[model samples]
Target chain A: MRLAVTGAGAVGRSVVELAGEYGHEVVAVADSSSAVVADAGLDPEALVTRKAEAGVVGDGDPGDALAADYDVLVEATPTTLGDAEPGFSHVRTALERDRHAVLANKGPVAERYADLRALARDGDGDVRFEATVGGAIPAISTVEDVEPGHVTAVRGVLNGTANFILTRMAAEGLDYDHVLAEAQDLGVAEADPSFDVDGTDAALKCVILANVLSFGAADDPADAREFTLDDADVEGIRDVPGSALRLAAEDGRTVRLIGEATGGTVRVAPRLVPENGTLAVSGTQNIVQIETSHAGRLNISGLGAGGPETASAVLSDVGRLG
Target chain B: MSDAPDGAPEDPEGADEADPAVDGGHDPGSSTHTVRLELVDEPGQLLAALQPIADNGGNLLSIYHERGNKTPRGRIPVEVDFEATADRFEVIVGALRDEGIAVMQAGTERYAEELTLLLVGHLIDTDLSDTLSRIEADASTSVADVSLAAPQGTAEASSARLRLEARTGETADALETVRGIAEEKGLRVVAPLAGVET
Candidate 1:
């Protein structure tokens, strides 16, 4: 597939760089300020180096990439809430031109799911967002394979930063502040870790999962329930003290920010789980556990974030479009 | 079953006594019975309590001894399941009580499910005892065990791990009750993932 990539973040860069190995060509690429377009494939090394040296992908308008000729639009922009801005508009442009769209941004799928679906239905393109939920974990695809109607629930430790802090707090008997500081130092958490620590990031992932489950299970797309971040009942790990982890540890358990999505609801909270259990993935690892009606329970765990890790999921979605 | 709290299957035994032929669910005169007992946390207390059921022609089924959990009076809570005729069940209850064993609940009123959760915040300032009693006051739940950690004294934030025993299939209700109480108290509840066992 010929891909037009947007948002020059880690995911977007990796998707551009690795598209060749995945047997695809990146015809267009864009960051916030600039874009580059070439009918004949763009050079991955030149793009990456240009972004590093000049802080921009090219001299073309960012909207030029949206109009670029491509078979798939890889929407890898930083996720935004509410209207799900420029990312949603980027995907809409692709589908409007009858090109498939693979999203690394959670905004379009999570907040404006119904609108995205409406666009996909009217156009010849199909939408797939495996990366929007569990990074490298094939959560959405596995649920698709099981057939969403047969899957009862999908849940997991979706966030790495929250899991890392909780794991360290339990292991070292430290409070949230100390472990969060350690996480920031290790680059596991961002400078303003409110979204990761406050459970918004995980909630967004579950909201996306809930959208998938709801839409996938409905016989008619019109009958499905659309979920957004506001529909989630989220609780962060910021308030969890060392004493709570201590109490859980005494009972052979620990805490993790677990996100769950059923066909009807989405919830993210710091839940007590068995210390050695599958969901209690240590460090920055993530786990997705799907409960099905006939096939029993399915668990998928791996690195939930990082440029290449998430980019790999985006590439896989492109492969599926083939 | 592990979650047969309040001995659901045993309740029919009582109704069956009036019309054994109508029920025909179990053996003509034999059915399972679960008795909740408060035994003194002592070496021979369990054996002494069980002897009554066996002495009264009740065949032991299973014993769930919660030694770590205690009643308000500090007595260990034990749940004993057994198969007995309707007539023998009455005798077993009488015999256990006569032996000074506090039969907290007998026959059909047993808790079948257990859940543990952590509450963090100003637990002491919010009247933790009232929070617990409110949870207990809910017909479907009882406070099984609690371990409190107040590292910075009672005035500051503290944590308490509460183990609750809820009637069969009422774990969600029990959690809702606790959540309501915790919300009013400004406490954060780290609840266990329901229906997900390791």
Candidate 2:
């Protein structure tokens, strides 16, 4: 397979390396920085060295540009909702050029789910965004494979940074600031950190999940209720004896942020699960527990937010496309 | 007559009449404001934070409660909007801190700008996850998007293109942060060939 990658950040780089390892030919690589096109395929190791030499960061149009003949387009650019100029433009261009698109960016899907899905439907190509929801958990693919009547609800630790913080708070008794600083130091959180902490990132993922599970509702993503724990009273919990435990415990069950869109009302929030529940034990790792009407609850867990993990998911999608 | 003495002719209508100054006091055209707050993960955290806003006469618009989402510090991010006087807004924010909710941004007007950059290298073999984490940690930037391709397997070196969204006016700082990570991990930073605003 001849592949073209847009965006040369962590996940993009991982896709290149992994695809190369899987015996695919990486033909073109693009980023905000210079795009590199190689006829004989570029060496990943050397490319990394070159990027280091140049001081590059953030997003821009692909530098090297895409070849008309590439078999697949792996879209892994930064996510920005409402503003569809770069990511939307890039994906649309790839699809227009007849390349199979494997999207890791949530912005395009969250903001333009209908338009992009329609484009895929109209074109003689396939578009997969499993990496958009869970980095390596295969949540989307699992849902796709289930017997239509078997699956019920999808829930888990969709966001790793939040889970990590909660875990630290629960086990280590660390203050929020101290734990967050440690998370930053450990590469578990971003510098701006608002997206992860504020619920937008999770909301975007929920939107993607809703699309996958709902099978294309012609509704706006903004309609979903997005609530972050920011406004919740933490001190009040301490005052309420066992409030932490109670918050984590419900109906004699532990809790997790569960996103359910069954029967129309799409809800995403922290809900209590039984202690014996699969999601309760999901821990800091990224886990997706899909409860089908028949299959009951099936849990999938792994490194959910890392670049390499996301790249691997993209590779899997590419393989399927091939 | 003696008790009615000096300053006023006691008209019973004086107390019943509405003061002209008081009648014209309220304005309906004031714009509503929203604040984005980042909170650390803990039990019963949000309630304490809301006390100040409620006490200070801030009308609650919406609370984006991302309990499942965590910040780099393992905290949750929350966005709250309210209608209040500008002077009262400050009091609400102060009261929130007094109750202990970390304010990430008080207003929607972004103090941070966005910059996009590209990275090229053997991202997989070199542990692209670590590389991304490092850059994000340094510049307080987020991994917005990443596109990668390797026709070959993991052992074979391949290149990836990354799209990063960093803080506004912090592009230079973000780039420096990426540079440090690239150097440490032996990755290449591909300077933008064509520049465009994010």
Candidate 3:
């Protein structure tokens, strides 16, 4: 497959490396700083060095450089769902050119799923976004497996940094600040952790889920309720007697960062599960449990976040396309 | 703004000569209290925790059940909120412990809002279940709902959209946390468009 990769961030970098290994011809690479194109094929190793030196990837703007010939346009730009003009432009151009697309950026899809889907259909191209949600988890596939009419609700722990911090707090009894610092140091969190803590990320995700399960279209991020872990009073959890200790009680259950969409409304928050429940065992592990009208309750849990794991998912998509 | 003379509108009929004991009914300034408790993994643990609040003159307002998670000791953490007088609040805490419910943390603070996210990826192929578990471990957030779609099987490239709600105004952090997962798992994030002013 001839591929054009946009963004060059962590996921983009992984896609480039994997696509090269898979013997796919990476025709062009786009980013904010620079764009690299090769007729024969660019060396992933050399491109990495160039990216580091140039401090950018792809063309500064979406123009002929990205709109050039390609079989598949792989988008991996920074996700800005509502205001992702750059990603949207790049994707729109690729689709307009009758190229297939595999997206890692959430901005374009979250904001314009319906339009994009329609565009893809009109262009007779495939747009697959397995990496958009659940990291390496095959959540979309799971939902697809069940009868759409039978599925009643969807829920899970969708964020990793917040979970990492919560795990640290649960294990070490550390404050939010300390746990967050540790997450950054461990590379589990970003330098700017606002998105993870503020819940905007989760809201965007909810919009996507609602689109897939209910409307067959994504909703506006503004339409969903938003919250963040930062608003939680950890000190309050400690100040009260038996508060912190109860989390570790012999029969206590603790599950953090939960999201649920039931009926017509979608809600997300932190919840304490009863011991002996499936969620109670989901410690530092990403889990998604779906309740359906026919399947009752089904739970899926695994390591949904990580480079190699996510790369494998992308590779799977490439294989399927092949 | 007009200023009326003190005691000028005093009307004999409007004057209440009722009992002095009822001078001030239900002090509006009275502070509400909250309690955090840990319960054994039992079916009625939540009910056991709530009994204390009701028995101690506390009106239940909210409850935060940190379940489907575990502590280092493998126990569950639960946060409960209720309205009560200062004296009655303390009694509620005592009653919870007496009923064998592990009290974790409690105070006047309440979870005013929650945020949720749906993650789509090869959750099973990439071990997304573990990721969900890790996310739920965060004290600030909890796994409220999940929906998985793996029509091609777990090993195949698939997507699972997870919904996660966090404390009020914590959506940014929640998404960031998810971004970390996306970065780690190489998953494409397709929703929650940025800069939409949600």
Candidate 4:
């Protein structure tokens, strides 16, 4: 597959490297300010090195890479909340051109799955975003094994940063602020971290899962009826104190930032998880539990963050296209 | 069991009988055991259910998985005939349960041993799901059935009847896993002095 990546961050670089390792050609690459295009295929390692050293991937702008020729547009750009801009428009552009778009950016999928799928249906293009939900966990593909309508619900600890904060507070008996500081120091939580600690990240990922499950009112760019982030009742771990964790622990349970979706409804809250239960996955790791009507409940857990992890999912999506 | 055919033992009565040597998949203690299983009607269901059997020393003889007929549970009814020794049969059934593959019936062998106990505590409030999961996660046990009694409501207190199936001598190990969960949850465990309850 010939590829063009939008984000020149860690995930985008990993995708390019893995694509090259898997023998796929990276026809174009871009960062926030620079875009590179090579009809004969760019050297992935060299391109990544250039981005790191020069703070730019190439001489051109992001629009050049978006307009560049490629079989699949790999959108790993940073997520935007409201309109889900650049990422949303890039995917729309790819589909409009009858080309495939594999996404790692959660904004577009959480905000526009209906519109994207509707567009893909009208054209020769299609979309796959396994990396959007649970990072490297095969949340979408594993559930795909069951017949479409058979999956009753999908639930999981989707946000690594939120989960890390919660788990640390629970285990160390520390308050949210202390744990947040620790997580920030460990590089698990970003400096601002509002998007993650405020439940927006998990809500977006849950909405994406809802959309992938075709929750009917699945989330969309238009913020459709059923599964929009607006409709989701999200409660972040910010207010959950270490005292709450101690109380739950006394009862042989722990609190985890759980995201849930059954049909049109999607929510993210601190749900009680068994200390040893399958959903009790901790730290920066992520886990997803899918309840299928037939095949029973299936749980998938693994590294849910990192460039290679997300890229691993992106490459798998690309492979599915092939 | 068939006696090895000696040169002088080619009797007239054995003319139409099946030759043990020609049974194709025959081994010394191997017997064709008919095991019934209920599986989900989905792709890879049969393979997932059958892999454990093969892994635990059961050789595939035939699969009578009926797609048209489902069990009362609405799952596909699959009847499998396989060749395995008596001891191998015990391991096979346990493995099936470990894989979460429903072994509806495995010939005359049903997990070799069963242990049931009474757990009294706040099952729901203290997270009964976690308690049950920990026991099930132990390789030695699987929760065959559970009965919870919370007449006073979930807040007050509750007791559950857990039917656990263990490998032949692993009943003690299964009981230990149960005991561990009980101790951790501040729950009381009641063990019957009688032989065993079905």
Interface RMSD of each: 4.4, 21.0, 14.9, 15.5
lDDT of 2 at A291: 67
Candidate 2, what DockQ?
A: 0.01
User: Which ten contiguous residues of candidate 3 chain A have the minimum total lDDT?
Assistant: A233-242
Put down candidate 2 lDDT per residue, A163-210, tens digits, no spaces: 666556545544456767888898887876667655566666766676
Which candidate order results from sorting by TM-score in descending order? 1, 4, 3, 2
Q: Candidate 2 chain A, which ten residues in sequence have the lowest lDDT sum? A: A232-241
Off by over 4 Å in 4: A215-226, B1-198
Worst 10 residues of 1 chain A by lDDT: A247-256
lDDT score at residue A66, model 2, on the 0-100 scale: 58
In candidate 4, how many Å is residue B171 off?
Answer: 34
Ranking by DockQ: 1, 3, 4, 2
- lDDT of candidates 1 onward, in order: 0.89, 0.62, 0.61, 0.77
Off by over 4 Å in 1: B1-109
- B96-140: candidate 3 lDDT, tens digit per residue: 656756544445232233433334446676787788877766655
Order the candidates by lDDT, highest first.
1, 4, 2, 3
Candidate 3 vs 4: which has more lDDT: 4
